[model samples]
Target: MENKFRRIMRTEIHKGKRVHLFHDRLVTPTGKEVEWELIMHPGASAVIPIDEDGKIVMVRQYRNASDDYVLEIPAGVFDKPDEDPLVCAKRELEEEIGYTSEDVTFLYKFYSSIGICDEVIHIFVAKNLVLSEQNLDDDEFVTIERYTLDELVDMIFDGRLSDNKTISAIMTYKVSLERA
Candidate 1:
């Protein structure tokens, strides 16, 4: 069950607001030394907020990386290094979609990029949502959107939504619903 590679050294190449890039030297299982790039992240939490109307709350926001707007669930990185993912989820839900939930439950966790990044996304489902004021960041221009679970699945297959974490969380949420 041991699969961890031996890391000989890691040097920070650059530090950004959300991620730190490093040059890492590692020894392979075959005993060969190699250099690799790694991105260190503070991790984040996402929420699938379900309202009393049985609709899912989402947001449409512009992303600099893609130079276009993206539709995805409410999510944000931990405010503090040691902040709990659940707390982050709740805060993001209220911030991005202008709603808070009385019930939030963890669904699963996943790595964003196994090869290069140490970013882990914790997914949650929230119910009994209460309306509140949208408190987006000064730089965040977010628009609230609502959709049903079936509509999200259609968007995934139709290529309208391409955020990896969003797709993964939606699929997982659908499957969880089936099992329940």
Candidate 2:
């Protein structure tokens, strides 16, 4: 079978430190041509840091995009283009929550927003955590919190836990535990 779609051209519309915006022209299978705008991201990793007592570590920070303080799992963009996701997850856990883990398991990965952006977020569950000093970025202001798995699930159902990565990681971990 012939290829159904082709990218006629892709032009960079804007470039930022963390993202790039592109305008793409493509021909569809039906011979229809369209121009689409897409945002390219460097990808990121998040971790659900579970301490020895089974409480999950989270962070509260002010998000400029949302204009509110939001609760989320510790996450960050890849330190380098070829950095491993697991390494990024561990780094973020320590930076945001002041905990390092010896047992870090990949939970899942997904596109945070597929319609307009190509940002893939890898989530991991970090166990056997050891407390350490947080190494937050100079501009970062985060407050750490701990909650049981059940408490997090309740927050998700009650609309309190609205961050996508946090919600996904917690729910995924809960379901995986049930299956085990």
Q: For candidate 2, write residues 56-150 as lDDT tens digits.
A: 88899999999999999899999776789999998998899888887999989999999999999999989999889899999799998889999
Off by over 4 Å in 1: 1-4
- Taking every candidate in turn, the Cα RMSD to the unseen true structure, in Å, is 1.5, 1.2
Q: TM-score for all predictions? A: 0.96, 0.96
Model 2, position 115: C-alpha lDDT score: 93
Prediction 2 TM-score vs. true: 0.96
Model 2's alpha-carbon lDDT is 0.91
Report every candidate's CA lDDT.
Answer: 0.93, 0.91
| Model 1 error, position 14 (Å) | 0.4
